[model samples]
Target: MTEKPRMDVHDLVSEIYARDSRRVFSTLVRLLGDFDLAEEALHEAFAVAVEQWQHYGVPDNPRAWLVSTGRFKAIDALRRRVHSQDVREQVSKRLDELSQVNAERAAREIEDDRLRLVFTCCHPALSSEAQVAMTLREVCGLSTEQIAVAFLSAPATIAQRIVRAKSKIRDAKIPFDVPSVQEFPQRLESVLSVIYLVFNEGYSASSGESLTRADLSSEAIRLGRLVMELLPDPEVLGLLALMLLHESRRAARATPEGDIVLLEDQDRRRWNRTQIQEGKELVERALASRRFGVYTIQAAISAVHADAPGTAATDWGQIVALYDILLRSAPSPVVELNRAVAVAMRDGPAAGLSLVDNILERGDLAGYHLAHAARADLCRRLGRTTDAQAAYERALELAQQEPERRFLKKRLAEVV
Candidate 1:
């Protein structure tokens, strides 16, 4: 008889680790009540799994196995810290109590651990950059190097930020529980911003061969849904809606060969109508509440695009008007760049080029490749081949993603 191909035990462990690591980590944090201890215990448990699962085959309940092992690991570490028998006995007693409580409350408590963990990482005491770094590292399970690349910072800098953030949480005694209703509004904004940042990175990876990091985007959306379920805030709904609306077009965002297909060129037929419809409904709800914020406005803008049958059929005037509102609400150079594109659609390429130049003159986006790429497209349309070629070359130098680099190179070839 022919033998079936044997799966590599290491690969099997890796797959299980990838799928269950977050869940197991959440439970560990809850049990240990210390980030540093929980992280250590979690890794130790996984290491033990690598050794044991090879001989025993994978556990029927991998997450449970990891969590139990992590809990014991934490107890062992605590025992080692205190040489006194009395202290060890006290620690053992506490562990017994915790284990019993966990057994009784595991299902419900584990479900909420992630939400609580998110709130703790996004505590206002931490700087915005630190909060984002911590969330990406702890909650999203991204490595420091990956977080650094996503945000265009050095890995050491990102590592320092995460370490400092964790130290602050410990020093300040930040509670690892959801904020009260009174403090929810302020804290929710930070949480939403982190989630949106994650989604944006996933939607358009900073540097890579692939145009999209679907896993990151999907994780962000999942977190958004969890936030909405727990809080149900208008802004949270809007945030989720915005993500869904953008994700609905993900199917058509790039060519089969992974080159970017501009919004005007994407095949609209491939858009996920279900997500668009849900996003539109959420946008309407947020708008009706009149308590909506930046996310809702962005979702409203995306809703307009999703409603259009084609690029020409899009409501450019409304889009430009929405951009005007967005600019007034949350002003940024990136917003201005997008508004310029809308203005171009509404007015003319010359008008857009003029705004792009103004942004460049201010040095607001001097190193941003998209800014130069937009200028190149406008220059090409206006028959200024020399200027277009220079802009494209600059954009190509600044571009990090392989697909974007290819596209810029192609544009430069045309102008040359």
Candidate 2:
């Protein structure tokens, strides 16, 4: 047999690491019961894999192998720490007990580890920002640099936040299991918010050359599916449905040259039929439950768009109604801005423009680029060329993503 190329070995190992790193990390978190220690063990296991897998060839079960290796690494690190002998003995004893579990049981436990990790990261004890940062880093497998870029903050600041969040988790002794049914509803909202934040960043990146970060969006969808499977709450289902409905249009959300394509202009043929079908079904299920919340209403609105044959055929009135309901449940300037857009489609450009102007006068979303961009679009539609030009200029100055800036500049040229 021909010898396998060395570069192929490196590529294969990298692929394995990318694919199984989060799973391995989740399992290690369960075994170690300390976020920092589990993270250290996970990296150490991969380092060992680089040396061992190259010589011994890949393991049949890479996730299991990594988990076991990480456990051993954690035990070794514990022994090295200058703590009481009792502490060392306790960890050693736990490792010994874990080692005796049958492979079948261990595999089952590993399957549930990701869910536990999600709940732990979204614990109410942590602040909302910290919960989001921790979930993005630990569950979504994003680097601090990537998270910082998403947050528009320095990497050091993001790093410090993650460190503080992890330290809090350890110090607070947050349990590594799903919250009880009574405690779950309050906790679940935070978990869903973090997942949506991840998806939004992926669906329309805040700053970068590309408009979409498919990797981040896809990772969010994967986590959404995992959460839905583990806990079939109505809102959880709604959240997954909402993401799926939006993601179905990913292919058509931008032009080949990477310019933004407004939803009304996007090619319906490019939308993922399978995802739309699934999302619509999920929306129905959520709505029928009557226990559905904000996410379900948003999914219903997306369903309306998806069901329409074209923009002219869209049920804008229904969308506006849904937005009204959404606003009542989760009132925010952003939701109000979206509602204004829907109101424009339902009523007229003048109606939408009036709402946008009111929002601007209130000075709530004055610095928000999208608010300015929306105003510019409305101004252009109403033949207010000078106002449109100024608004576009403001949007261009505020926009950070290259694609968005390019889009704003293109709009500005048309008005000028």
Per-residue error (Å), model 2, residue 237: 1.7
Off by over 4 Å in 2: 1-27, 36-111, 127-130, 141-161
Candidate 1 structure, TM-score to reference = 0.75
**What tens-digit string does per-residue lDDT give for candidate 1 at 1-416?**
12222466578668877766776787788778788889999999999988877666776666777888888898889878987889888788878877675533455577688788889888888898888788878887889998877666799999999888888887888888888989988888989998998898889977877788787788789879877876778999999999999999998999889998889998999999999999999999999999999999999999999999998899999999999999999999999999998888888899999999999999999999999999999999899999999999999989899999998998898889
| Whole-model alpha-carbon lDDT for candidate 2 | 0.86
Tens digits of per-residue lDDT for model 2, 1-416: 22445557678768878877887888888777788898899999889977877777777777787888888888788778838888778867877876775433366577688889899888888887888788889987889999887666799998998999988877878788988889878889889988898899889877778788777788789889988977888998899999999999999999889899989899999999999999999999999999999999999999999999898889999999999999999999999999999888888889999999999999999999999999999889899999999999998889999999988998898889
| Local distance difference test, each candidate | 0.86, 0.86
lDDT of model 1 at position 372: 98
**Model 1 lDDT, full chain set:** 0.86
